[model samples]
Target chain A: MLRIEDLRVEIGGKAVLQNVNLHIPAGETHILFGPNGSGKTSLMLTIMGYSNYKVTRGRITFKGEDITYLPIHERARLGIGVSFQRPPTINGLSLRKMVEICSSDREANVDHLAEQVNLSSFLERDVNANLSGGEIKRSELLQLSAQQPDLVLLDEPESGVDLENIALLGESINALLNRGVKRSGSDVHKGMMQKRSKSALVITHTGHILDYITADRGQVLNNGVMQCSQNAREILKWIREYGYQECMTCTN
Target chain B: MYKLDSNGEVNPKDFSTEAESHDYIEDLAQIDGSDTAEFENVGVETDDSNRSATFILKDLSVVHCKSKQEGIEVLKITEAMDKYDWLKDYMWKDISPEKDIYTQQASESPGEGFFIRAEKGVVSKRPVQTCLHISKEGFAQNVHNIVIVEEGAELHVIAGCSTARHAERGLHIGVSEFYVKKGATLKYTMVHDWGEKIFVRPRTVTHVDEGGVYISNYISMKPVGSLQMNPITYLDGKDSIARFNSVLVAAGGTDMDTGSVVVLGAENARAEIISRAITTGGNIIARGSIIGNVPGVRGHLECKGLILNDGLLHAIPELEAHAPNVEMSHEAAVGKIDQREIEYLMARGLDEDEAISTIVRGFLNVDIEGLPPSLVRKLDRVIADTQDDMM
Candidate 1:
């Protein structure tokens, strides 16, 4: 559902992602593996149409529409959501208020959504203000859930979360992508079958999130270049056996 | 006559004739408005306004409102003193003993104001709503208010002050003294809405006795020429609590200087002062001070300012502790709104302006706990109205 063609992005006149091409078909979840400063965030931001990214050569198409020149809010209106690795703390905006702003349904069950991530107590608290690592992740997930975006971009959701919360975060991500096990009867599932499939591009550093999310494809990004595209588990095994340095010699 | 210096010290002004003070009062009386319609927006009942709460208009015109509740009396200061000689002792007792600029201005030509008294063991369920409005140009409304909450009594007061639209230069000086007796609780909320040429000076003082609770919420979001005020509260008895919350928005050449001082004078007394100031193309100075003088006393002061566009904001917070067992702390911050916060809100489907308005509203939202639901709703409406003006 999303396509990036010859994307060359720069930040502060320095190229961060060069000649990168990525494509994720409908209903497909792609896993991006990269080390620190490996342009993963740069690619995500470029896809999200941040002006500071300076897309010198890029044509991003989402749902067959050119969104490369779209503003951040316009892209959000077009069903795009992201969870930052280290989101900035908003001093006075409450978590529940942010959810109300993000929700497509004016009367969305924010309490239920917050309950899913165990953030009911934080609903009244400031967004990300003095929140711990896991709590920030849960808060971001809560906002993403309210957004109900078709294309979700998660930046290292498993980075700071503990083991117990990570499971909850995984379940939230699954529910957000509409890939969770259907608890409603088969009749309700049949009615939802006609809906459009959800897509996501998850960025991970440790590959720990793969334990919960079933990624269809995996790609290795290193030094502002995409080297290999292969099976999600195979790439993880390759990286484990021989670090990212070996990806330079591998064929796609 | 006397004038208060910038350092809060009283200085004698040049002698003025009695005729000059009479002329001031005459000029004030020229601005007349019994409409009470303008106050409806602030959630104050105007139809039979006196039946609900005490009503005060411009100058010394209409102040004959009687409290419907037993053990609660709401009347003009002069009337209250004339009716009950005991109230004379509380009048002008907590404010500066020597006349300052505000006090002198108020005394020279006193305007219509309320004297609210909650008798001992009485709990006033309804808030005393006071509205002070100016409708004419070049007029000054000098008011003096006294509130006495007797022992074990509870009272809530909401004061709305505003001026007519497109009005010429005007001045408002209000001197308020509050006495919260032992085990009593008093919640006071003041909302100010002034025109472009209005100058406001409000001097307030409160004395909280043993186990009394005093909560103050001050908000001024409309445009004004200039404003300067420093309200002080003394926790004079053991276990007394005093909390002050202020939210102000200065826009379009308005100059506002607001501050609060909380003194913890007795053992185990606690005080907290929190202020939030937002300036858009204007100048604002937010100051807060908390003093812990007795053992086992705790005090905290927080002042935060948000500057938008070319506006200027200054935050000055001070903390003092005298006793070795006292704990005092203060934090002051002055900066522009965070771009990331705006962008974060924008990404949530809100346009830039909408995002900005939401953030501004959030910044102004000071959660005042323990307020009645009705008062909370009224306060929310006032805040929402002010935020609409901010946008």
Candidate 2:
């Protein structure tokens, strides 16, 4: 239930996403594959409504509603949530308190969510203060579990994530998708549901996310222009063999 | 008292009257008291023209009162040659001692009169300290002092008043004035610790020149009836500054009405006034005002009071700014000391009284100034004693 057509973005006078077109349907988890500076992170940042990236021309429709210019908070309220690459350190504010504030249900059980993401130890700590990289990742997951947003955006979740909790991350994501039945009557069951999933645009530069999650469609974005949107396995194989130079030449 | 000649040599000032001046000299010579050398020109007489101009401070030890009076026992000292010249004319001939007229009950007779003045371009780095101690009952002490720091000069003075346990119905009224010249700086500290049944009224006026700076620090403890103090400051010259830092405590049926005012009349002038009070079994009212009229001038006033043990604290702060470019802000609040902090400290192993003492010390330490390290250590001991008493 997501659509992108002719997406063109300019950042710092440099085009990062050009003429990009892709579609993610209900119940599918898609993995994006590209080399460094392939505009994968830029796409995620733009989708999350970060102001640093400018959209020159594009249309992004989620559930038949255009949300290209929506503010970050509004998008969040509309069930679009993002786990930042680097969380900010906000002093005098507790992590558990923020999770409670962000939860869709005011009476959401905080201890249960904290246990799900292995963030029970940081309940009293200031938000992101003195948190290890892995701890911060789990804390973000805890928030994600609490919110249970309709569309979840994750950036470099594998980075700095300890091996002990990576499986927990995958399980938490799966549980988040399986929760809170919308009016659509379609619920995720953690199988080959990627084909009919509501949609997830997972951004990855090294294609490492493919090992943990499945993908239905893949796109190769070089510099600012999309070379092609092809099968996820095919793009992974091509990049593993001939490298991104092939994508650059294809864009030229 | 040492005397300074025209050539600036050490000598002795003659204190005897004109009729007794020769007899005093003869007695000194016959007694072989070499240390009591007299000077003929000492104790210079003041002219009537100069008598009405300078501020006059009567020495506390030189007065006699036959009966109890409601008004100040005015002591006129126009015949003293060692008197400071700037204070010769501004002396008030009469001052009221009525309950409303006096800020507090006057106590303890003073010993000898004293005078101090600063010439232009002179600076004194060390603070001149004086201690007034009253140990007798129904004793009235009156003191008037004048200070004039000429242009480009700097001076610091610290005065303290304390009394014995038996001191009762004591009255003290003192007035002090400062004349600050261009580019001059003056810092004064007044500390009061009086016994029960003591009344004190103190008024001070400070005038600052262009580019001048004036600072006053006041500390009060155990005022019997009431200790009323009003410090008025005027900053007329550009780039001038005036600051008042005070801490007042009124306990055991005492009432204190103390405040300060600063007027910034020129561009680039600055004024800051801060006062903290702790009231326990007493009444305290603190009010401060800062008026800034010129552009680019800055003024700030903050008054805070703590009420504990059935005491009352009232604070009012007013700030006026006429120039758009000027920064002026005033805030006042009266409340009890936070109980949460005390509980936290207690949870950390400190007893309740120890915790309270720590909080009071921190609150009173709003001005950890340039006091000597030794003096600071002594003050720490004093704080420890206070905490022990509270506990």
Candidate 3:
């Protein structure tokens, strides 16, 4: 449901992502694996239409619509949601209020959603105020769940979360992608073969999140270039065994 | 009788003109009562012909009327002294004895004020509303208000002060004293919406007895020429509590110097002072202080300021702990609204202006808990109105 054609992004007069091409068809989840400073987050932010990430060349199409020039809010309204690696703390804005703002219903059942992410007590607290890394991720996931976007972009879901909270984050991410039912072991093959409508583009450095959600495809990004696209598990295994430099040599 | 030196200290006056003072009172009386309807804009229920709460409306220096409410006795200062001998013992009992410039002016040019008392064991569900309104131009209105919540009683006082739109430059000096007796609770709320040429100086002090509670909520969301006040409170008895909360919005070149001081003097006494100031184009000096003097005392002060445009804000918070077992702390912050927060909200479906208004409203909301539901609703309405005005 997403396509990028020779996309180049520049931040603060420096090119961050160069001539990148990516495509995620409908009903599929793609994983983008890259090392540090490899333009993984820059790609996600540029696709999300952050104003600071100037698109110097090419275009991005989501569901056959040109969203490269769309504003952040417009993209959000068009069923695009993202969980940032580091979200800003909003003082005086309550977590529950933020969820309410994201929800289509003003009086949505926010308590239940927060409870799912083990954040019931934090509903009244200010958004991300004095929260730990895991807690911030949970809060972001809670908001994403409320939004129920068709295309979910997760930036480093497993980066700072503890082992104990990582399972919860995995379940929440799966639920957002409509893979929760399949993970529950009730006719998994049937659920996976039903032509899932939700799509996702998850960025990871360690590929730890692949343990929970089944990604349809994987692509390695190196030095602002997309090196290869292959089977998700095969690509992760190759990177783990041979490192990213070896992948660059193989792609060349 | 008092006189003012170049230093603005109170000095004894040898002689004064009675005719001049009488003429000031006469000018006050000349205010047509029909203008009272203008108060409706400031959240006063003017259409309520049966106005239940005790009201004190001062037009310049004249006492328009002092109405009494049930379960609470409201009397003019002179009438209170003449009616009850005990009233003499309570007047000026809690405030500072040494008169400052404002207190001296209040004494010298006396205006009609209220002596509101809630009887022992009585619970006044309806608030005692007082309005110190300035209707005339180039006049000084000096008022002295005394409030006493007797033992085991509860009272809520709502005071609204404002000036007429066309009113010229004026000065208002109010000296208020409050006494919360043993096991009593007093909730006081004051809303100020003054004209551009009005200057306000309010000197207030409160004393809380054993097991008593005192809560003061002050809101000034409209423009005023200048204001300076530092209200003080003493938690003198065991288990007594005092809380001071203020929300102010300064615009139109208004200069405000406001602060609160709370002293925790008895064991287990608790005190908190919270001030939130929002400056659009004016200047604000927000100050707060809390002192813990006895064992087991806990005190905290929080001061936050939000500057919108070319406005200036200065915050000064002080905390003192004299006893080893006492805990005192303070936090002060001044900043502009975060653009990221606005963008976050915008991405959540709100437009730019809507996002900004939401943040501003949340910043101004102090969320004083345990207030009466009706009063909370009224405060919310006033806050919403203020937000609309800001937009």
Candidate 4:
């Protein structure tokens, strides 16, 4: 559903991501494994068409349409949503109005989705103002749920979240991606996979999110370049044993 | 009207004697349709269902003034002064005529303003609507208003001051004094819309007794030539409270300097001042000050401004504590809209223009308590209608 080929990204005249090539087919969830400052979020922002993340070279295709130069709002209109790690606190813009903005025509989903994400009380609050770590995560999920996008980009979903909240967040993500209720499984049923084609690129540091949701593939990005891609669980086990430095030598 | 014992000859011409004066009208029904529309724009309507009392001042005359509610009293200040001998004590008692030239001019030749009072033990359900209107060119309209809320009473006053559309230039000087007795509550709101060449100066003072509450909200969004006002309040008795909220937007060629000061003189007294200003090629000076004179008092001052284009926006916030255990704090910011906030909204599916308008609207939407729904809706409409000018 989403493709980036030979992508070279720069920010403020300095190259941040070089020679990145990846693809997530329809109905698939890809796990992006990276250390700090490894340019994983840069790729996501580049695909989202942020003005500062200049894609100096390469093209991005979503749903077989070239969207390399779309504006942020246009990209959002074309069904791509992002959950920022540190969203800005917008004074006086309540979360309720934010949901209404995200859900253009389907405003009916605001209250129900807010209830599912456990942020109903927060709907009246100003956007992202003085929110705790877990509250920010749930607020983002609530907005994404209202958006109902075809593709989702989650940056470090479990970084600041506690253990129990991370599991609950994973369930929300799974429900968003159309994954089944069976947790700790890396396979989706054929009948279930054929029903929906919601794709996502989830970035994780510890792979603890693997316990609650299924990821079809995992790609290791080390220092501005892609290193390796393989079965999700096997790659996590290997990275846990050896470390990210070992993946720099893996050709597969 | 005051008779001059000095042969009716004035020297050192200020705004009062130098400017042209308009003829007085005996009845408001003789005015034209457009003049009535001008009155309605600033929250004065022909329909009295929404207001308990209505006072209309056209230039140097009180054309129409009456109170429909039995517990409330509304009349011209000059007539009310003669009706009740004690009313003279309330006028110019807290606000000195020697404070400024505007006060001097208003107190010396005081054209007719309103006198509104809430009787003791009465709770008014609807607000008293007052309109101060000038329909003649170069007219210097003087006004001195007195409002008294008796013990255990509640009152709300909504005053709209504006100039007639055809009247190009004018000057308005108003001196207002308010008294809130023990266990009383008063909510006063003023909305102003004027022509580009009008100069306005209003000096005001208020006093609150024990267990009393006072709230004042002022909104002026349209363009004016120049305006200056600084109203002060004194919380004298124990456990008294005061709050001031102002939303100001200055367009090109407009110069506005406005603020408020509150003094907490008794134990457990509290005060808060909040101001929001936006200038699009105009000059604005937003000021706030709080002084604590006793222990167990708290005060906060918030002044925030946004400069949309090439203009000036200055914020001055002052806090002083004279006793131990007095809590006072202030927060002030003056700059352009944060681009990060704009991008964050854009990421949520709003276009650039839409995102900017939303942020600007949010910035001006201060949480003011006790505003009637109609006035709230009118303020919302004004904010929305001026979106293009602010941009």
Per-model B-chain TM-score:
0.85, 0.71, 0.86, 0.92
Candidate 4 C-alpha error for residue B108, in Å:
1.4
What lDDT tens digits, residue by residue, belong to model 4 across residues A1-252?
Answer: 899999899999999998899999988899999878888888888888888898889989999989999888888888899988888888878999988988878755678888888898999999899998888988988888888888999988887898878888988998788775643346557766665858999988788888888899999888889867888899899889987777767633
lDDT of 1 by residue, B1-391 (tens): 2333467333212322111221222222233243344554343455433333555565335533546688888887777778988877777786763556657767766666788889999998677777776665666777778889999999888787877664566777788899999999999978787877667778888999999999998877767777888888999999999988988888777888889888899989998899888777788888888888878999888888887766888888988888788888888888877777777776777877777777777877787554444445655665565455555
List of chain A TM-scores, every candidate: 0.93, 0.85, 0.92, 0.92
* Ranking of candidates on lDDT, top first: 4, 3, 1, 2
Docking class of 2: incorrect
Candidate that would win on TM-score: 4
* Residue B262 Cα positional deviation in candidate 3, in Å, after optimal superposition: 1.6
Q: What ordering of candidates by DockQ runs from best to worst? A: 4, 1, 3, 2
For model 1, the stretches where C-alpha displacement exceeds 4 angstroms are: A105-107, A185-196, A248-252, B1-34, B41-43, B47-52, B97-99, B108-112, B369-391
Candidate that beats the other on DockQ, 3 or 4, i.e. the better one: 4
For residues B86-193, could you state the per-residue lDDT of candidate 2 as single tens digits? 344544322223323332232122223334455577656445444444444555555555566778877665555655454555656665556677998877766676
How do the candidates rank by TM-score, highest first?
Answer: 4, 1, 3, 2
Alpha-carbon DockQ of candidate 3? 0.48
- Poorest stretch of ten by lDDT in candidate 1 chain B: B15-24
User: How many backbone clashes can be found in candidate 2?
Assistant: 38
lDDT of candidates 1 onward, in order = 0.78, 0.62, 0.79, 0.84
